[model samples]
Target: MSEFIVFDLEFTSWPGSLEQDWSAPGQLREIVQIGALRLNDDCSVVEEYEALVRPLANPRLSPYFTDLTGITQEDVDQRGRAPAEALGDFLGFCRGLPVLSYGNDMVVLGENVGWARARGDEVKNGFLSATFLNIRPWLNFIVPETADANVGRLWEVLNLPKPAAGREHSALFDCYSFTAALKHLHAMGHWLPTGFL
Candidate 1:
């Protein structure tokens, strides 16, 4: 059966004006966490992968970042791997499956690929070649009533059940919520693209 890799990422950010600059090569938001769920053609869970990526240029986690993501500095310091290494492992886990994500995961991933290339890390070309589909637009199309809904309002618009208490924002929880919405759409007989099947 075909597999769909649903994924999400959390990146480093500061509280105020000093936050990492997206345009600056050295100051771009470094991916801190990656959470993914592998699903069979039937949308049943097949496997899961989660990783903590250590920031290279900006190793310290800001207070606001901690409050927002609940990922403490100690968590990254003790458990995180370097971005290149973490991404390498994540790619292996994906195994060339089509990727499904929310928001700008592909954009951030492209930025990360540039970051790795600049550092002379060997990233597999296939990683860049894999299909990436953003479900937000499809979600909007499926539920025209939610055409204007953003991520924060997606749950209500999709009528997806709330996730387990206190489980939002973090990569895995976001994946779960997104996957739930997709399943709901599928059950409603909405036509997902063949790539998703």
Candidate 2:
């Protein structure tokens, strides 16, 4: 059975800390948390994973980031980990399952790879750079631009049932919403083509 591994990542910040550290060419910032739901060929939820990683870079959490994601400094201080280790753990769990992320969040993943290299990780010998399923581009190709310009806003516009609101910035919450959106679109007869990366 074909399964889709839908995921969402809560980052260290909005613009992200790694953006400024261009010296870390192949590394990306730390993922504060990662949540994913594995969907069966029938689009039924088969499995799920979530983790809170300890931050390795910034000593202080940005106020804006906290406001946007609702993840407090205390939460991060208590849980975040090194970026390479977190990515390794996440990737280990994911295995060979295809990843589906919202919009340009994959760029964040790219940043992760760079950050890993900067931290002396082995991502350079790992998965290729374009190795993620970006749901935003797919949605854009199928849905009209007027529907909802922001890929992040797809949940609000599509309004998939069963994902309780108010968990917006949480990784697991976003993953659930992403799955709901895909299911809703499938039920509406929108088909995702094979071999789409």
Top candidate, metric TM-score: 1
Candidate of highest lDDT? 1
Residues 38-137, candidate 2, lDDT per residue (tens digit)?
8886668898787777666655666867887888888867776666766766676566667777765667766776777877877423454225666676
Where's the lowest-lDDT run of ten residues in candidate 2? 123-132
Tens digits of per-residue lDDT for model 1, 113-193: 788879998776546546787876777776887666544345666777874344566888777777777777778887567
Model 1 CA deviation exceeding 4 Å by range: 16-26, 145-153, 164-166
Lowest summed lDDT across 10 adjacent residues in model 1 is found at 17-26
